[model samples]
Target: MAERIFKYVVLGGGIAGGYAAREFAKQGVKPGELAIISNEAVAPYERPTLSKGYLLPDSPPRLPGFHVCVGSGGERLLPEWYVEKGIELILKTEIVKADLTSKTLTSAAGETFKYQILIIATGSNVIKLSDFGAQGADSKNILYLRDIVDADLLVETIKQKKNGKVVIVGGGYIGLELSAAINLNNLDVTMVYPEPWCMPRLFTAGIAAFYEGYYANKGIKIIKGTVAVAFTADSNGEVKDVKLKDGRTLEADIVVVGVGGRPLTALFKGQVEEEKGGIKTDAFFQTSVSGVYAVGDVATFPMKIYDELRRVEHVDHARKSAEHAVKAIFASELGETIDAYDYLPYFYSRSFNLSWQFYGDNVGDTVLFGDNNPASDKPKFGSYWIKDGKVVGVFLEGGTAEENKAIANVARIQPSVESSDALAKAGLSFACKI
Candidate 1:
């Protein structure tokens, strides 16, 4: 077995890993002290792009263009960026075993690495239909997007099956975004989900109605109240049709399932305290195991704003929590003080020239505003979550930067609302003033 050592090691080269490495470099790390072990062949890039620009038929974002930090308008950390900083980029390396107590990780190739500090940013894995024992799920062209490999394969399949029928299985952001993308490619798109409406986790029925209608206007089919149960593959094992639980069969040239994701915590299971289907961490992103940190989708940490422990799966929290972890590490080393992480849940999605932003918790009674007519030109609308007369969350679609900022502020400050009527009447104007 090969053996190596590093003072700091970031496991999983995703958003949290990349950003954590960047923070470590900023705080100062000597040559040979920092290393990033990743199963991917390339350096970390913006994963959110996989469902968006990367799927675009025209001028898709290429590597180094959408690297981490670039999404947030920071310096793009290309492979050379690590080289220049004397940070080792151990790409295409998968850790097969992790002994947290020993502060060591063994790769699939039997290579072992010891670290003084271990950042567990392993991220997540795509939920496969096979996981549910769906028949014929191994059929070819039955794809799921998670990493660049998955996105690239989808792109190639799109080219091979241009103007073909695409059945997107799932109504969340992935399904919605890919529906728009496949439609833009001049293909027939049909979305499938078991929910009454799309994005039930976030979108209100009112909000979903607009998108459902808008998607219809875009010539995309929305099949709600059902799910894909099995797939029919051709003699070549390529999926040709999708069998639905609701007894509706759809001809599908390509099927993409985006049901959901589970955090990558199996390696640390029983070795770490877990909650909410993720490794539990404090505001500082430090796990129960000393010197073992967690971030990104795998880290369920305290959300001070909500006064409850929350696990944020969005890219914003990934970047922020990674940097915060590094800061906390260095602070402890240098005997300095730092504030606990206080994060406001922020999520956004863009598709078919329409964009939306949401901030804060999405609980409580909702108040919808603006025109939600799917066919209207420049249709703008928003919603507010009111709990005990205070706005707990804000959602705005087709908002200007300034307007989005205003709603974000409302979520941040959580100002009190006198009445729902006044809040509705004021609408965007209400947030603008606040």
Candidate 2:
């Protein structure tokens, strides 16, 4: 008699999907019982570095961190790993439609597969300039830093026009990082944001001002309180300029759009309950559909700190949610009830010479701390959110080892502002003294 094998099918082979498939395989699932499907030809790869490391000439080619098999050097995730682990790899395939009632999925190639369990890790897509009508919307000089292909195109374009003007249309992490990198190439760079400060969504007004000055000091043109309305092109169909909502026009040879990313839940549009343009999932990362799970950028789950539902598109959230989704699957397999997934959300980014780290939810009244210099190299700052005198969130910039630990401690205790002198102690030495 043969052992009963539980078949698992993972859709979307990006970070979230790849990690979930690897976890399911690690649980002693047989290759014949597991299948990983990806829409792209190449295996899953790390995406966060695509905007930074992959764009640089000195950095090594980035590959997917999650692997199934051990190779000759035991470095790569080989096809044999899936074979030995009883997991099948389906490359260059896409799940066009999913039938939850029949527990089956149909691929674009017309191949059908049955899965006892399914994981949706489709991740998110970069918000393009077409949505904003920026210069790079149709020009060959325009590029996005979303995937390896985009990075490669950007490298080629940068090499061809080493001294051209590069205009970035977002002050978010990706936009800021890319602007810094392109500026390093000695190209004239300009960053445009609708908000008055950088990273307005992630950082407090003071911290955002700090970064605004940080970029401005590096000779990068920072255009705030302006939104890109349309693109201006030359007769040759090349991007020549960009029209701003403030009745200003900026000349540009290249345009990069990094406005933000939206969840890639289009395929599951009618299947899942979506709000704010993302799939609505429960505490366990389970969607409205049974036996089906959604994780990463696609999931909008409840946050204990915010006391409301939120969707996070950061890489840390993707990794943590994948772990929780796997645990939920295991519990379901054993017919055991599981607890809700509760983890503090965190994200980081590097621009110029500064590294920014943030934790918890910044959805409440914020108390600012540290040095508030927009031009200081050693400036460090922190923001704590208090509700009913209890700390619920913390955001730190130019953080120290002690500050990192302190932020974590604050999260656990839900501390009151009076308990710690994070503000007075750090004082003028740190940025955001207020």
Best by lDDT: 1
Q: Please, what is the whole-model Cα lDDT of each candidate in the order they appear? A: 0.93, 0.74
Clashes of each: 0, 13
How would you encode candidate 2's per-residue C-alpha lDDT over 1-434 as one tens digit per residue? 22222477777777676566666755656557767788877666666666765565455355554242221123355566567776777888877887777777777777787887778888878887777544447766767777667887888888887789998988888888898888888899999988878878777777777777777888899889988888878888888888898999999889888888877787777777887668888888888998788888888888765567888887777767886888888887888877787777777887666776766666667777777697665887767776776766777777776766667666656655554365346542333221
Identify the runs in model 1 with alpha carbons over 4 angstroms from their true place.
none
TM per candidate: 0.99, 0.88
Q: In model 1, what is the error at residue 47, expressed in angstroms?
A: 0.8
Instruction: State the lDDT at 383 in candidate 1.
Output: 97
Native-to-model Cα distance after best TM-score fit, residue 290 in candidate 2, in Å:
1.7
